[model samples]
Target: MTVIPSLNVPLLGVAVTPLNRAELLAHIRDAVQEGRQMLVAGHNLHSVYLWYSLPEFRDFYDRAGAVVVDGMPLLALLRIGQRARLRTEHRIGSTDWLDGLADLEGIQRVTLLGGTPAASTAVLRHLRSLGGDVAWQGIPGDPWRAEDVDEVAEEIRAHDPQVLLIGMGMPLQERIADQLAARLDVPVIATVGGALDQLGGTQSLAPRRLGTMGLEWAWRLATDPRRLAGRYLLEPMKLAALLMWRA
Candidate 1:
């Protein structure tokens, strides 16, 4: 698999990988050529909540290849919670990986799952603009549960991409990636929440200034108040309780 060793930084009882962004990307590129399938995961607050509070997510991540800090707070939390000396130069999330995949060479094929047909098609068009040689496929459907995974896996196998991008959002995407690890012939599977939507022009990201200040969550909460209130507020409070209980 990936020869690059992952720093084992466990937060709220869930294992997280803190790796240099450049190195990990290179390793993923190399692993694809070597035919060693790698399952990469990136964690946001919601992902952390699920990993710590749900046995199902905890188990799946334990079986993953590498997990990066997807949210800004997650990076700080990982360093503060465990292996204090750990220093990951970049907060390498799935969105960053998606950008890299489109920009980087040698990766021949990719499959995108999630986003509406319009959004997914837009994402494919963007990827094509970045690189003409990268073939793309969009698995246009949401498999909300484990039982639905079999048919989804079938669709993925039919295209058989070197990199599989799952964008169905948090827990669902996490579960889907786990189910496909053994079922599909893809070399890499990644979970990117709404990234395809952002790329497809369906959604917009916060300003870089806001992101650098770690106010990205606030921006999201403001823009999509209805959808994010529970995630940005309730889940974090629940997570605090779990952390205190653990302590």
Candidate 2:
């Protein structure tokens, strides 16, 4: 097993590994070499809320092989509360690293589950353009549900890919990735929320500069306030109260 050091955050009742993108990919490469099935998941502010609010969500995270720190806020809290040595570069958004998976030495076949047919096509095209021996395939999973787990697993198993990337948002993706990791022999099963859409150009990624400065949430809020205002504004307050109460 590739043992990445993790720090416990009592505030969120979760553990986060401070890994930059290269380190994460190296870990994934090691997992592939060891022939181990690993679920690569991440934690952002929204996931922190779900981690506390939903039992299944918490369970899924508890079982993840790697739970990377994905948001600046969560990274800050981890440093402040845990008194760890995490740096700004430790916050790894999935969009920044998805492309690198194609270059993994032992990975030849990758299957993606999630996004629209068009979006999946776009992602596949981009991955193919990377000029690797990796065979890429995408299955449309826009309306994935709990009942579809078995069928989805079957479809992924049929592809016989070495890597599986689940992009269905949130709890759903985590749910499916957990089940698939248990059912399939894929070396790496990644729960990448919205990464497919962003890679496919269906969703606009926030400017890289904003992300580096920890203001991507502001950009997302500005772009889609109706969908994200509560997530960016109200949820932090709730998370703060939950942390204080737990503290």
Candidate 3:
């Protein structure tokens, strides 16, 4: 196994790896070709904070196939801290990566779960445009309940999807994917956040320029200040405090 460099956050045992976007895609492609089941997860600062403080969250990441570097700020800090030997030019988001996969013919039948109706619809439209054969479903509300599980599982099994894409946002999506993997025989599952919104036109993505600069979070905050401002600003501070306390 390849060992990424260690991150020294207080109470956090998370590590940064040398892997970049190309490496990530290559691995996923290989897994698909080999017919192996895989799970891909993306983590931002909020997720990092939660993982450090929550045993269950940490366990989820520990079991994931690839826990990616989703936030530019997090990647920058990792590079500045020299915690990982990652390539400075390597940066990619989950949405773009998934879009790329939509073009590949060997990806197998795909199922999309989670996200609001509009978001899921948009993602389905985009994938169809790319000529992929995808099995799509959108949960109208929260999918954490046991009833939701049975219903979603039945749909997934009925479709017999080889790959599943879930977009319920952090921890929740990850937990759902984990449970689905245990309960079902799907080979690959990916947990993506807000990707459906961007695809569906419900949420606008940060401009390419801002994204390149790692200020996409600011754009998101600007677009949905009421929804994001408090969480983004306060979560990091809380995570930092938790880390310090652990130390």
> On residues 1-247, what C-alpha lDDT tens digit does candidate 1 reach at each position?
4433455545555566666667667767877888887778776778878888788878767767777766667667666766366444556655556767765567877899888777878888887887557778886644355576788788878877899988988778877777788787788887778888877777877775665567888988999999999999899999989888888
lDDT of 2 by residue, 131-152 (tens): 8788888998987667878887
lDDT of each: 0.75, 0.84, 0.70
Which structure is stronger by lDDT: 2 or 3?
Answer: 2
Stretches of candidate 3 off by over 4 Å are: 1-12, 16-18, 83-89, 132-145
On a 0 to 1 TM-score scale, where does candidate 2 land against the true structure?
A: 0.93
Better of 1 and 3 by lDDT: 1
Best by TM-score: 2
Give per-candidate clash totals: 0, 0, 1
Candidates arranged by lDDT, highest first? 2, 1, 3
lDDT (10s digit) by residue, model 3, range 134-182: 4454553333465688778888898787678887777787778877888
Ranked by TM-score, top first: 2, 1, 3
Clashes by residue pair, model 3? 37-187
**TM-scores for every predicted model:** 0.88, 0.93, 0.86
Task: List clashing residue pairs in candidate 1.
Answer: none
In terms of lDDT, the poorest run of 10 residues in model 3 is 1-10
